[model samples]
Target: MMLENKVVAITGAGRGVGREIALLCARHGASVVVNDPGVGGGGEGGDAGPAQQTVDDIITAGGKALANLASVADPVGAQSIVEDAVQHFGRIDAVVNNAGILRDAIWHKLSLEDWRAVIDVHLNGAFNVSKAATPYFREQNSGSFVHFTSTSGLIGNIGQANYSAAKLGIVGLSQSIALDMARAGVRSNCIAPFAWSRMTASIPAETPEQQARVERLKTMSADKIAPLAVYLASDASQGVTNQIFGVRKNEIVLFDKPRPVRSMTKTTGWTPEAIADELIPAFRPSFARADEVSADVFPYDPI
Candidate 1:
């Protein structure tokens, strides 16, 4: 049992990816807290049915779980959710920051309200839950955080400015937390998943003849994305942190770390024209691949 005796709290566990993760964790021997406010895809208020349903499913599968009906967007509520996990299961060993909402629009057409609502739920909600769990993790001297980013965040997507920004912010946050928690035996990583979740249901099929093609391309199941997450949260990945992975059907690609390129040294000032003509080119998009240049040409030197 990879997660024997572990305690995991997952936000948005009422449905979709979060629910899948909760079930998997419980099956591997973890005591799970399925947290959700039962909100719909648009983030509207609702009952706790979704969360309870997940719990019932887990119990039926012979797994241990508790349903938590709390809004991840509320810091107080998030804190209480963690407290409930500790109260029921003794300690929290991991957290899956999987709660999110979407508001899609092109850059110029996006309203302030639309942007704020998405950012509040996706980015701020991650903060609320992670902030509450950090103390517990530090005290235990070990923990794992699996944050859900998206391909829209990694690359870019039309009609998703708000969602992309929020998801990218989570990746940055996860990296920083990885550094802060390194010595405490904690690990943090993000996953950019391509899965068939409720969030992508509205994407239009480009042509009637291409309907099957569209369905094929969009039908990567939530279960397919969970194994990588499970590995990251388990003990096998103790040495891995501060990384991002793109997971889809039968494929997992590691994202590259950011690197600097094209350093220029000048002992004297240059004219604006020279700066524009020379410096700009050195920093152009083409220079991004300069890291692959022959290392022998820039051999290590001691001064």
Candidate 2:
């Protein structure tokens, strides 16, 4: 009953993590707008059954729900989807920016088309939906945004330059929105979820060993990632914003933030030799550790 009477709009709700989030929200008493473009993992458009099916399941369970087959990559479509939620539910309370596409390629092999396709859907898609929902949230003086990021983006994955860049961009976007909406009672947070979904179907299983790894990963179902999302979308997370969370199985981990390791004094008459001697140790990657001697030692004494 945490989400009783709450109205939430979820992009990519047709299947996978988005679908699970919609179902969980409904189970807890939310009225959901299940939006999906019916696109494949690569963003090719197709049928609308996925979104409709989720809505049907929710309604069957005695929950309020609606289906929207709109491309979040399109600003007009994104706006219309939010408008539909407001028109049907009479208010918009939360948005899950979960729609995305994958275009994997090494940096040199990556085409402009491949890069643009991923960016358009994942990065621009979040922007389109968030922008459309912001006015309503501002007007209502309350809203929550759960933006989907990925470990690929957080830690950098192989052959996913396009996908990783777009996902990381969502983190920056959510943080900025969180700061902007602080006083408006709107909260925005990023979720890096490790769930076995359609997005990872292309992972190969050529050998029994490979298949075993895949099977192990499958244990982290999409359903397991939904509860954290529902909490973030509810009133319980009002004080939580501009944060990043990693969700998998029964564990939820918050990612640590970055901070400057050492501050150097740039003084006049300092030569390249002086810079090499003093700053080189500070520039070492190990200096990133707070407990490292170089990081703990003050390179320059203050007057």
Candidate 3:
């Protein structure tokens, strides 16, 4: 009962990781608000069945829960999700920004429409929900924000320029919120989850390697990511803000925020030639490989 008497709002709770988190949070004593417009993988079309089903599951389990069919991409809709939680439950304790859509494309071929579509739902959507919850969090003097990021952004990926940009932007958003709200007893953190879901299913699997990767991913269930998210949403994670975590099946990883790994300071700012000779050589060994993608960074099977 880590979350007894608490209320949590979770976006994208219709299925997959979001659904798992919502259900687990309710089980741990938090009144849950399950929000999902039930859009397809590419953000096209919508339905209410997914969100309602999650709510039904929670209620059937004897937990307090409610369903909210709203697109997090819409500022007004996003606000309603938070407002609904407060109106129904009397207070809000945590917000999980998990709604997302994929429109993967290589950088050269990526269109403006796809770029905006991805950004609107992922980066802007996260901001919209978090912003709507800020006042309540500030007044209550306690709240948590658990944002979903991805290795496609944290590490690297192929043909996901828009997705990568939005995901990385969310990391920055999470960090900034953590720093800005620390004094108000608010916490913000990110999770780079590795799971097989509708999002992953959209990845092109035409090649042998790509198909193999998908098969490997199928072994990792969406539920495997819920425990850490539930912990972050509860009082148990006090003093655990401003962190980025990776959840791959049974393994959990903490990531170091970007910092100077190798430094070579030129007292008198060097010319281009001098930098080429000295700084480049000094930093070469520490430089990450330009070709490495998410799979390369995590070559082993999920543990």
Task: State every prediction's TM-score relative to the real structure.
Answer: 0.88, 0.89, 0.98
Ranking under TM-score, best-scoring first?
3, 2, 1
| lDDT tens per residue, model 3, 143-230 | 9999999988998799999999999999999999999999999999999999999999898899998898889899999999999999
lDDT for predicted candidate 2 compared with the true structure:
0.86
- Per-residue CA lDDT of model 1 for 44-119, tens digit only, reads 8777899999999999999999998888888898998899889999999988899988878879999999999988
lDDT of 2 at 73: 83
Q: Cα deviation in Å at residue 26, candidate 3?
A: 1.1
- Most lDDT-accurate candidate: 3
Query: Candidate 3: misplaced stretches above 4 Å?
Result: none
lDDT of 3: 0.94
Q: What is candidate 3's TM-score against the reference?
A: 0.98
Q: Which candidate comes out best when scored by TM-score? A: 3
Q: List model 2 lDDT by residue over 14-130, tens digit each.
A: 999999999999999999999997888898866799999999999999999999998988899999889988999988899999998777877899999999999998999999999
Error of 3 at 247 (Å): 0.6
